[model samples]
Target chain A: MALVDDNLTAAGVAMEGEVSDYLALLKPRVMSLVVFTAAAGLLVAPGPIHPFVAAIAILCIAVGAGASGALNMWYDADIDAIMSRTRNRPIPSGRLDRQTALMFGLVLSVFSVALLGLAANWFAAGLLAFTIFFYAVIYTMWLKRATPQNIVIGGAAGAFPPMVGWAAVTGNISLDSVVLFLIIFLWTPPHFWALALYKQSDYAAAGIPMMPNVAGERSTRNQILVYAILLSLASLLPLATGLTGWVYAVPAIGLGLVFSGLAFKLWRAPAEQMKRNARELFTFSLLYLFALFLALVADVGIARFLEMIS
Target chain B: MTAPTEPEMLSKEDSDKLAKSRRGRSIALALVLGALAIVFYALTIVKMGPGVFNRPL
Candidate 1:
């Protein structure tokens, strides 16, 4: 009877691992943010990129993001199976073999970068290639399991799409493009640290050295507030630098305030407040960045079109 | 979805099926990638110069 029971449990575990592996492929949340940010950058860049190129650029960015996700999954499969939150991932669940994921990631990484370059310019393609390397090699393989500051430096990989988009159109980078990159770079720590605070146990169980896992919740909360304030300041840079007008400025200031407000609330709340507040901050932080980027796109689109005619 | 009940990787016939599935996926992947590249090249590079789409309409 014990033998049968053991066999059943083993089979059940295998099935769960399989499903999580596929979910790891989709990397749905990451894809959502990448697509939107890349599209906004393309729309607002100084020149007209064919709509088709714009679509492809976004697709390539998404594929690159997925590639990074797959690589992360492949590397972290062992730990993922240990954590409750990640146990359902494909590799962890044993639905998809790690070898299959590694092949998929490599193919997508090569395909997306090579194709982006051919479609746009070597520069954009190069950026995509570097992004894949940054996330998969530097961030995933090196940083993520090593240090608490992993997301801070690693976040730049996520921040590259807008620059890639600008390069797609302009064939060069600009200060405005850099500003977009900065916005995301600064925003990432607070956004992720919130999740870290809420999911420290998952990180602890997985043996991943996420900041909150290494630092106690008190220290992590302090870090979130500090980063949040820094992010708010960075968010306002578009106006101070004159990269954007009040069309972007007004909302940037307003949204920055609310984002900071939430961060502080998260900081001050009791340990129990950590989960709910962190989730709220995570969800709202996404909206904040999206709105900011959309505002910039709208301003640039309207203003540039007016210039072309007048 | 339930994976196959077989514990072994594949018998000769099953290997054939696996090969076909993989080939199908690869071909489909190639076609999709090709189509996507074509679309991007047309928009990003071909129609990408100054005033390329600046018509007043």
Candidate 2:
């Protein structure tokens, strides 16, 4: 019995985190969005790539994105602990230690970049490496704390995945990929600002300098409306560039109108209704981006089907 | 140098939970490694083609 007690005590000293806790460090929801947009970029790019290579490229990209998330969680664990929304994260909740998270992220980042270079082209690998660095070092450590424009610039990190995906296939950047990057880049401000509007207290408490915390809510609302209009216009560029046809154009126009309308509503919302309006815009913004990307992919698929039949 | 502190004792339930967690991590690690091996193997076949088998010994 004494030996059993001693062994249990030894086990207790070393807190082994569950696999799910480690996965939580990866921010799976964000990873899903990264994967979807990256896959869209890969599929929509005009090229013949080995399906196997395509799968490997996407896997590497997902792992790299998840690696960045882990690094972000490790660095932001302090502010994360202060915010109710992030208080339950692995590090903040003490399910995993920060050092472990850092090491996990570093290892995965190296592996993902190296393997992508081997499986795909070096250009795509370089983009992935830059993306990880941008998110982990630039956005998380620097921009996030220092400036109100954090999300505006940090949004570039998230915007790179699809471009990376396109590069994986074409081995070069093109106007179409740039247009895809622009759509996400412009969409990010309004999307994140709306969330900040409702969660102003969280950012204030965490000293995050989010737009709504740094700028007044009214200023943030106006900026969100402007960005929403810009994003809508940018979303139609695929059609203008002849990268996509009417299949993409029709949905793009409709989605852009709805997105801008929500932003307009939020801008004019009464103080009492501000949070609800912001939340509605935030929720719809996600659907809007997802639908827009889905439409792009669907347009490509339909075009391919028509070409094959003809 | 600081003296080593005694380890804290855990209840049987906590010990069991830790053991389960450790096992789960091991399984996940194994699956990831397996998937990686498959990826490399497929990549080799795709890149090298029948030439993979024809390499000089």
Candidate 3:
């Protein structure tokens, strides 16, 4: 019995160091968001792409996003090991070695960018390469430890995917894609500040200069409110530009209001309920972005259906 | 000269486990390399298009 128990424990420990460990290095949740937004951009663009080509482009974008995630994990492993929220990440948990993760990330980055250039166009591929560099080098290595404005600037990396998708289809960016980018860029600060409000100690412990840590909670809350109001207006730009119609506008306005309302509530919450309020705002922010994007896609789909019937 | 020193022996279960792990790693590496080869080959086909065989001498 003792021998079997010992073997079982050994097996369990060994199982932790598997292919899944390497996959976890990719940060799959973030990759999913990138994929969804990229696909929406592709679908809404004013060009026809073969389904196979579309699939290949989206795959390359997802792989490129994954590559950036892996590189970030490789670079941030030390701080990840220190933070309670991130201590169980692949590198921090000792499931994957740092050198192996670094090499894996580098190889994936090259492969993803090259494949995207072949599958789509050089413009989209260039954007992917730049996004990876911006996230792994600019954000993770420099701004993360240096300034409270890290999220505001680092948000550019995440906001580039839809534009890349647009370029993949159109071979150029237009005002429509820029509006998509701006919506995400404006939305990022408040979304991240809400989480930072609740995870203040984790950021402090990790030596990261997240807004709530460098600035007081009052300042952070005020900034979140300000960004929320800006984001609410920015979300309506697609409607104003006629890229999307009322189908998208109604939800954009409604969800934007809800998001701003949550931010205001968080700003006004008592000290005792601050954590709960921040968490609520963080959760709602995710829904707000997703619903906004989905509304755009739906508006396009509905217009196409009507045209076909007419 | 003395006989060559015998190699350290592993227990039967330990040796079996080691063999399995090595096999798994080998297969994984081979799959990755094979996939890379296929992707590069596809890119070549896309780049050359249908004109590769029809080019003039």
Candidate 4:
């Protein structure tokens, strides 16, 4: 991982002097979802964490995610340049050098993991370390270029943040945390496959074998529908297991139905209408995830309010 | 280790950019070190409990 200075200099000076380029390397939009879900995990865990400590834990998670993003950009620069959606990324656009990104990611990864261990527990820190490794190496380096199930398996990296957050407070994993993990893990394929359906040509051009590129669109749609049904069931597990109250149960079940319905609609869409269906499913998938996690947080808040009133 | 002093080969603009970058790096390093110090302090306080930093006087 020690990228040589000469190799970086060959890419020439940065095209832009703005710090936003560095921030862009972090994939902040994705990081926001990681932070939000991690916060929900931290909140709904059994024990209390000092607010300051909770802040630090979230910060560490966010930084770890950013580290993963930078490393991914560094490694995927070649394919990124070929894909229109990613061509203007900091590295491929020449706003930042690959070596600089490599160093930035490495330094942040070490700092976040170490700081989390100090602030929380070794288990949480270890989970975070694994997450960074999984995204940067397991997913970006290997699976992305290798198989159609790349996102399916690699989704675990995104799923781990909530578990890490839960562990930060509990110092151990539990069934509840696993449920949270399962929700995101199962949600990943359908969410990404919808985007993949519309962006199939981009992946083909980049030589990346996303599901829509490798599998026929019909097969991919069928698989997505199956995952969507499974995801709906997983989303309701929290309430079924009595981990959360009705505040979460009602919306969780409702969103799950809507999510599955969208998937079914996409599956039934004609070839000419597939892209439009995919875009609709993709848009709703984001809302589906945010709403599910928000329900979890809202349940805790409502319980606290009732406790105070009584 | 200490950072190298002004280099011989860089143009004025490049030198300015290098200086600016060094300054930014230094400030960031200081902030991180400062935050770590506070976190360690907070952890110590938590470990020691309420009265550790307090005095009747």
Query: Weakest 10 consecutive residues, lDDT, candidate 1 chain A?
Result: A10-19
* RMSD of each predicted structure: 7.9, 2.5, 5.4, 5.5
User: Which candidate number would show the highest lDDT if scored against the true structure?
Assistant: 2
Tens digit of per-residue lDDT, candidate 1, span A1-310: 3453333333433332323345467588888889889888777777666666677777888888888889888888888899888887777766777787888799889988887887677888888889889988999899988899999999999999888888888888888889889999989999898888778888888778888778877888888899888888988777776767767877888898999999999989987777899999988988998998988887776677778899
lDDT of each: 0.80, 0.93, 0.87, 0.89
lDDT digits (tens) for residues A1-310 of candidate 4: 2443332242234542346677898999999999999999999888878887888999999999999999999999999999999999988988788888999899999999998998889999999999999999999999999999999999999999999999999999999999999999999999999999999999999999898888799999999999999999999899877788999989988998999999999999999999999999999999999999999999988888798899
Better of 1 and 2 by lDDT: 2
What DockQ results for candidate 4? 0.13
Candidate 3 lDDT for residue A121: 94
Q: For residues A127-165, could you state the per-residue lDDT of candidate 2 as single tens digits?
A: 999999999999999999999999999999999999999
Better-scoring candidate (DockQ), 2 or 4: 2
Which whole-number lDDT from 0 to 100 does residue A109 have in model 3?
A: 91
Model 4 misplaced stretches (Cα beyond 4 Å)? A1-12, A15-17, B1-37, B46-57
Q: Which regions of candidate 3 deviate over 4 angstroms?
A: A1-16, B1-57
- lDDT by residue (tens digit), candidate 1, B1-57: 987673333346644544555566666668876986677556654655655667787
lDDT per residue as tens, model 2, B1-57: 999976777777777877788799999999999999998998999988978898679
TM-score of chain A of 3: 0.94
Worst 10 residues of 4 chain A by lDDT: A4-13
